[model samples]
Target chain A: MSVLKVAGARKSFDKTQALGGVSLELGAGELLGLLGPNGAGKTTLVRAIAGRVRLDGGTIELFGREITAATNGARAGLGVVPQEIALYPLLTARENLSVWGRLHGVTPGDLAPRITRALDWTALGDRADEPIKRFSGGMKRRLNIACGILHEPRVLLLDEPTVGVDPQSRERIYDMLAELRERGVSLLLTTHQLEEAEAHCQRIVVIDHGKVAAAGTLAELVEATVGAERRVTLTLDRAPDRPLPGFEAGESGVVVRAHVRDVAAEMPGLLGVVRDAGCKVTDVEVRSPSLQSVFIHLTGRELRE
Target chain B: MIPTLLRIAFTTLRRDRVVQMSVFLLPIVFFTIFAAIFRSQTRGVTAGVRAAVVDEDHSEASRRIVAALAEEKGLRVRTAARPEGAPRGAAEVPLDRARALALVKAGDVPVAIVIPAGFGAGFGAFESRAAPIELLSDSSDPVAPQVVSGLLQRIGMTAAPDLFEKLGFSLFERYGGPMTGQQREAMRRWTSSLTDTAPAGPGRAPGRRSAAGDSLSASIVPVRIVDVLGDQKRNPVVALTAAGIAVMFLLFSASSAGGALLDEVESGTLERLLTSRAGMGTILAGKWLYVTLLGVFQVTVMFVWGMAVFQLDLMHHLPGFFIMTFFTAAAAAGFGLVLATLCRTRQQLGGVSTILILSQSAVGGSMFPRFIMSEGLRAIGRFTTFNANALDGYEKVFWREAPLTDLWPQVLVLAILTVVFLAIARALARRWEST
Candidate 1:
């Protein structure tokens, strides 16, 4: 059964329709990535599921129990990490974790062990007693995530969890999430990092203009949007006199590209054409379609735009 | 490059409403409030010195003096009381010495005039060694007593000229042979029609009595100033000053502490907390409680400093002081929360709270004595601003030395205001919950 499910959630802020019937689900022990361009309703859908937002028309179910703003009994099982670093700057890391733990109804007996584990997980054991204001951006981001998971909620919502952090911290955060998944804690995270989503997420849900544009694994998204054709490229020593048949010249006349389903079978023929065109091929390259291309194909815009 | 920098700064300032309000509007607001306060003190309708009058001797001279005092535009004379704790239909009785003294003690009037039993016999007897007229004054307001004393001297000269003339004739006879009956009769006829026209009125001549005028007019009336509170207080003005400054700064710090809510909202912590087990109401109540406790601590520190350095007599008034302090801090915390919730950003809260607290402080007697303000402005401060009631409660504790039970009215008003302010803050805070 799904640990968290939001179906047909609709929300409008003033005249702007922030979420128009967007729906997604987080399965038990699954890591789901919510992908969208800016203002694409990923945060709105997450907020609705986390009970921070009231949906105009929708149902949010956690562990098979319906959750609404008024009926929030199931909310205790949900944890949310906002896009901004929400911890008090002057407070120590342990203090912030303790506060968030208590706020989420963690008992005193369990708070200490949870904070200890969170400190170890974030790799800030020695610096746990220091004020967070003195911490680096990546350290603060790790602690921000630690603050959210102290209560041991079944479903976690992380919005831009790696936003302003270095790559080393990002790797550590994904490792931490992988451990949580190993412990059977389902997670739903929103990110503009398409590469992170492709590498770590068990499933991806792409939302655009307040609606879900595509949802599936990387292979499924690739097949649905840009298809699974690998592109072959040849870098010529000099400019070609005429265009090669069955190949298009790149922006630089010295480079030409062609798409092929099977590179092993098609590369020799492609290389023969380069030679027949009186162009010596200096470098040959073949690459599969990536999530970025799939995202651009689906949204018709870059993720950051 | 300098011109570009200037343009950049100007453009940013123009777009920032908080900067505009702080730079341009706050000064205008403060200037207007201070101008109104000073104007009311000098020439407004409530500029008159409120004096309670007691007439022990109802002789012709005493009655004439009382009449002239009542006619003086600079003095507001109250000669009767409706009887304290009396029924609604109780007949008003003339003010006696005890009632008049009570009025001065209770701060109902700054000063009280007592026309002694033999003041009429000694009227204008330049060297007769007669009993002097008594001016019972509360020393807290140094201005009212002085103003009343000067006006009394002017009234003594202008109100009863015939008595002066009679004494002058007797003195002339005693020194240089008896005056002729013709001369005495002529002087009496000339002084009988003197209508007490001295050009001495409020906001004009007598109101501006200087040191020179005071000395020149000192001999007309043998007046004794009895400071009602000076003898009891170690440092006479310290209590009022401490209370006023303490309450004003209490408001400033409380609002500042309440700005933590805005900070939480801006930092996204509030949204995170809302998703926790605690609801919005719980979060607000926690913040209000924190700010209230902080305010209490802030005021205690101020008063303790006052006691240590300035001899404020805080230890003597502990019970009433604590009671007033708790309620005052609670109300101020609520007021601060209201300001925080009413504005969106810290800058907006800063500009808005500055205008509001300063305006309230000026009109509500924190910056100056409320008794000296015009009656209209006093009423506005009492009705609209929380500072007035809070200060009144403190005065009752420190100045009047009244028991804690006497503070019910001020405490009740502050308690009601605290509830009202919290309600307004909570209502305004709805924007942060589930939006």
Candidate 2:
């Protein structure tokens, strides 16, 4: 069963249409990634699901219950971690969680345990009492996510949750999200980090200009956009005088490059052809189609753009 | 480097509307308000005092006294009438002593004059028994009563000669039988010349100028001005300044607290809150409560300090003071929230709030006393949330010792303003939900 369903979500701000007939679904325990360039309606779509933005026209359902508007009861089962660090800098990590937890309708009797569990999950247990201003960027990011998940909502929507964290914090955040997925919590996250999405998300949706551009597994997206091509590069000891089919020389003229439909099937023949042409192969490298290449190919721009 | 720094500064100032307004507009507005006040003070245009006259004696002497009071430029005299069974459109009816005293106590009129029965007949008669004319004043209105008292004293000086001639004839009739036409003429001439002449050198008795000079000045008995309300001596300037500064900072604190909404928006906390079970109303209400409480606390601290350092009478006027403080804070908070909702950015809010709050303070008498402002400016001040109402309410409580009922007008205005501003803020906050 779909844990969260959005259909024909439409919203406009003045003359700019932020969301135009956008639709998506998250299955039970699914980890879905949303990718878009700047001003491409990704945040708008997430906000609509979180009930922060009122849609001009659309329907949103959580666990088969249709949400017609952004009301408190409609958003009761949802959790959202916004792009910016939304925790109060003057408040301690525990205090921030308690405030947000109460706001989310967690009973005071139940709030303490949930706060403790959330703090433990985010690995901020030791620093729970410390003010967020004194925390490292990674710690604050963990606390930010912790604040949203204290109520254990059925669906969680995160917007660039780990924008400027160190590598260690990023990995920790990925691990925490993985654990949440294991616990049967559905997740939809928007991020500019293509590698993170590619590494963790079960499926990905690319949105551009208020509409879904593509939605599928990584391989499916790769096949649809860049056609499963593998980029192969072979560093040579000497330049080859003769040219090979569908291959080009690198800037130094010693590196030979080719885009192969199947790297495993073409590497031996390509190496033999280069050897026959009087070039000595010093190094060989092969790269499979990645989300970055697929994203660029589909959106025709960088994520930051 | 110098040129580079200068360019950067100018660019920043030009780019930021808030900075531009604070730097360019605030001083000009303050200067205008204060200059107008100073000019008014130097020109010495005393504000008119509202008073009522109750003539129990319908004689010519009583009528003359009433006419003299009506003619004073600074006094606005209204005849107090018995409201019982009087026609709705009746221009005048006699007010008894009890009714006149009631008017003074109720603060309907700051001062009430009562001409006792037989006062007119007894005028200038050395032996006739008559009660002294009474000037009943509301102690709560310290300043207006003083003005009324001064006007009465001046009226006495003008009526001295007539009183002296009457006294001379009465004494002559008692001692030497009825005076002939020539004797009466001589007495009138002597009394007129005696009043006209300057006192013969210093230290000579003012009454020694003529045989009846003492009796003459003594015949026009000084009006007995009595303060019906409690006499709590207070410095009006100190009270006004305390209230003004308190109100000014209350607006500032409220606006600062209201600006927290923009901060939350920029920080994304508002979006997170919206995504929670709390609705937009809940969020705005929470902010409103915080700002209101902040203003109350701010004003309390200021007044407490004022009491400690400046001897402000906070303890005696606690009830009126608190009522004014609460309403002022509530209105200020509402104003702040409306301001925040109207602007899209913190910079925009800052520019708008600075222009609005400072202008209101200047025109409303938060920076200067409204008494010194021109009628037009005073009218404008009256419309401001603080000056002609909130601050005025505070001054009345602290300096005038006004009762709760007496402060109802100011309280009503502030309460209405608070409701209106809150409604506007609520409507404007819908923009956030739509975003």
Candidate 3:
């Protein structure tokens, strides 16, 4: 059964609309990546789900119960790692985890092991005693994630979880999320990290200007966005003035875009054409579609812009 | 639950050197400034007297009397070579009656006293007449002149016993009769009998007005001050300092509450807390609890320091103090919360909180003591929460030493204010999220 459902969610701040009629269904163990540009209402959707903000016009159901406004029970089911760090700078990581546990009504005996496990999962056991103020930005981000998970809620909402984190820390975080997803913790994460989403998310939804422009698995969305055929690129030293059919000259006469039946079927022919063009033929490469390219094609703007 | 918040607040206070200095150390600095300002009155009101002694009589008695006036503590003596050349009247003497009046206009000395040329002849003639030396005093300066006049009067009145005995002995020697030691003792006793009618009149001399003031200034006789704010007869500085502290705490309470607002909003905990099991009222209650305790702690520290320095009678004034402190703390807390709620970020809170606190403290008599402020300014001060019940309470308890029953007026007003603020705060409460 679908445990959490958000249907036709719309939210606004002042006159600026943040979300418009966005819908999602989370079944057990579903790890969904809510992808969008910087101003794509990703944070807003997360906040709305966590009950930190009231949706302008929408219905949100969690665990088969409708949660129109946030209540302690509804909130108890949600675990959010906010974009901004929320742990007290003056508090040690262990104390920070303890506070969150207590806030969720965890018992001290149960709390210690749970905190230790959360820290261990984040590979932060050695740094648990240090105050967050003493931690590097990457460490703080990990601690921030540890805090959100300490409550062990059924539905986890992460907003840009790997933002501003070092590569090592980012991988550690990705591994932890993978483990949680495998363990049947349903997840809804908002991220601009397209690669991470592409690799980890079971399904993807792209939101733009408060509306869901597209939703599906990466392959489905990519197929839906572009034609079945792939585009191949051939590097040349100079552009041939002679007519090269179905060829578009790219930057500095070095890159060229051409339609192809199959990347493998076209690479040899494309290289021969480049050699015949008398352009200093260089390497040949197949251009596979990325979420970034899909987004740019769909929105006509950069993901961040 | 409460202890956790306290630990957070104090830990933040300890960790933040900026807040520590602003809240705690700044007050000590202001206290030192205030102490120094009041300490200026520690010296007698010594106005310079610009006058010439005629020395026409050339008698030992004339020289003796002239020498006495010259050496007078309140008179900063300047001598003119000749009596005729001496500044003709009060205004010419550096700090004489007319000179003091001009000084009041010119903003120089607030007081002056002139000893006339014939003062010795008059003192010698006191056996036949009631009056002795003529004391021309400048009364333009309200406080200083009265002080100078009183000092001079007491000086002569206290010396009357010896003068009377000397005159009596001179009179008795006109018959050329040999006198025994018994006769001298009898004359001394006879002269002492007129001590009751000495100068400065009726009861005790004006110089001995307050025992606490005696050690500081021998000439300054501290008296009941009729306040410009409410026409209440009280000690000016005592009322002012209490008002200052009261106003200052309003700023502190507001700032403290405002900081909490920023932290919650910034950390996104405010929405989480509201959405949790904790009701809006509970959230507000928790915040108010923290703010009130902070305010009470601040006030207690200040009062303890004040008592250590000024020996304030906090024991007797405890009940009235509690009544005043409670409402003051509550009002400031409400004000601060409103400012915080209106601001989106911590930086905004910082800017707006400063403007509100400083402006209120200025009008409410914190920046400068209310006692020194003008009438219209005092009226403006009355509208502010700091000046409202705080000044009244300080005047009643510290200055006038009124009974608790007599302070019911201030207590009632403060309670009403606390309620008004609380109502406004409750009305403005919105169950909102940041998305």
Candidate 4:
């Protein structure tokens, strides 16, 4: 079943268009990634799906139900971990989960085990009772995730939930997503970290300037990468102001280009040709385009810019 | 959904410590300021005034009149050299009717007292029913008229007993009865004292007595000072300040609640709340509920403190006081919501609320007394709800003995003000989420 679908979604704030004609769909048991630079409307799309924002022109559907004007109760099947930590710092992890659960109308009799199970899912069971204020960034992020999913919503939306956490916590979050996938939980995530999306997301949607640039499986995206062609680099003992075939100048050293399917496969022959030019190769490396490379190729600007 | 919204509102209220402290502390702060003002010493009307005694008749009665005016509290008697330029024996130009009026016009003395010619005829007429005493006094200032009137009444009260005694002795003399030895002795004593001690009449040589004994209470009798109104006829300013401070902080509490709204928006707790089955209206309603309750609580605490320390007796007149104060708080909270919604940031809220409070305080009669101001200024004060409901309400409850029924006018004004502000607040709130 489709967990969520957005068709021709548009939203504007003041004079700034935060989301413009964006559309996407997510399936059950899938890890979908919305990738973009800052101000790219990734958070806006997530908020639209979470029902925290109103779409100026479009509709959002969750679990095959038209939820364009869904009341908060109509959204009980959904979970959202917002871009900013929404958990009360003065409240403990357990308390935060209880608040979310109670607000979602979980009965008191069913609350305890639910909280415990949620804690265990996020690896926060040991620290569930500690105040969020006393928690580390990673711990607070984990609690944030736990609070949203405690009621076991069918679809989960996390907006840059791991942005400011340590690498260990990042990996831990990846593992938790995997566990949720095993439990048949559909997840939609927005992140700026391209590699993380490439690693964990089954499908990555690159959004730019408030619209979707690309959406497909990782292999499909990689095959369709904007800087899809690979560049071969030959590092010399010193900066060799030397001529090379199909070469583009780079700041660090000499560079040569080839398609991933073509010249990258002929690296040895290319290296031999360089060798035959009476120059010794200090080091040789083959590089393929990444999602960032794809982004730069599409927008003709650096992702950070 | 309602519970969740209420929880969010209450939680937000509890979380912002600065707003919380202000909301809770405003009433106390105002109470303290007003209490201190009320507890200060009261100054009587006519504490100092210059007057010249012109002795056309040097009768003992005129001297006695001068003596009486000298003994009066708050009158600073200045002896002028002459009634025209200056008096001979008086401290300053002795203020007769015309001179005192001119001095008052020129802003010299608040009031001037003149013992008129034939002044002893009035006293002698009481014994023989022949003539009445006439005194000239400046009545330009409202307070001056009141002071001159009060000083004259005091003299009349003091002289009534002796006049009756002399009249009784005269009556006895006319009856031609075999007078008792004691009665004859009393008549002889009166005659001797009157003949020997009486000044010629009317204006006597100015004496130094009016300066020696007058205390400050004899000044400003018409203007009801806060202190005079508060603790035991506290200085009129004190009572006025207390009432003003109480109402000011009540409005202040409203802004504090408004501030909490900003905190909620900033916290992302509001977002969490909205996404969780709590509609924006539910959240807003809950916030309004909490803030209004807080305002009521703020007023109650202030009144309780006032009653405890200042003996304001909110309980004895509990129904009236509560109804008046509670509605005032509600209206204030409503106005506060408008302030909060219009302001985009907490800092903006701070600036806006301060402006609101100061403006209201100035026009609402908190910072100063409005009665002494001109009719136009007083009319300008009535434009603000704080003045319309507050002064009228306080006057009805604190100064006058009135029941809850009397507070309906104030209540209606405040209620209407509350509704208008709340409507404005609601309209503003819809745009606030985006801001």
**Candidate 4: true interface contacts recovered:** 0.47
After superposition, the stretches of candidate 3 with alpha carbons farther than 4 Å from their true spots are: A12-16, A70-72, A107-109, A231-284, A302-305, B1-243, B267-280, B313-323, B343-359, B362-380, B394-408, B429-435
Q: Chain A TM-scores, one per candidate?
A: 0.95, 0.96, 0.90, 0.89
Q: Write the per-residue lDDT of candidate 4 for residues B258-350, one digit (tens) a residue.
A: 777778778777777767766666777777778878877877787677767775656656676677777887788788888888887887688
State each model's C-alpha RMSD to the native: 2.9, 5.8, 15.7, 14.3
Order of candidate numbers by TM-score, starting with the best: 1, 2, 4, 3
After superposing candidate 4 on the true structure, give the runs of residues whose Cα lies further than 4 Å from its correct spot: A12-18, A69-73, A89-95, A107-109, A119-131, A227-286, A302-305, B1-243, B307-315, B369-379, B394-401, B433-435
Clashing pairs in 3: A20-A210, B50-B94, B90-B98, B91-B98, B91-B99, B95-B112
Global lDDT of each candidate: 0.87, 0.79, 0.64, 0.67
Q: Report lDDT (Cα) of residue B368, candidate 4.
A: 61
Tell how far residue B240 is off in model 2, in angstroms. Answer: 6.4
- Poorly placed runs, candidate 2 (over 4 Å): A70-72, A244-246, A301-305, B1-16, B23-46, B54-63, B82-92, B95-102, B112-154, B157-244, B299-324, B362-387, B391-411
TM-score of predicted structure 4: 0.66
Winner by lDDT: 1
Cα DockQ of the candidate 1 complex: 0.77
Q: Give per-residue CA lDDT, model 1, range A148-246, as digits (tens).
A: 999888888999999988999999999999999999999999999999999999999999889999999999999988999999888999988998988
Give the winner by TM-score: 1
lDDT over C-alpha atoms for residue B275 of model 1: 87
Worst 10 residues of 2 chain A by lDDT: A67-76
Number of the candidate with higher lDDT, 1 or 4: 1
Q: Tens-digit lDDT track for model 3 on A170-223?
A: 888888888887877888888878888888888889888888888888888888
Give per-residue CA lDDT, model 2, range B1-435, as digits (tens): 999999999898888877877888888877887787677556544456667888888886677677777776677677756574468786656667777777676556778888888877766554437567777886545666666665554554454445646765687798889988997788879877865662222223434434433344344444566866555465445766788888888887888889899999889888778777777888888888888888888888887887888877678777887888888898889888888888898888878888888788888877766654566677778875455688768756865566688788888898888888889988988877846
Name the TM-score of chain A in model 3: 0.90
| Positional deviation of residue B127's Cα in model 3 after best superposition, in angstroms | 13
Residue pairs in clash, model 2: none
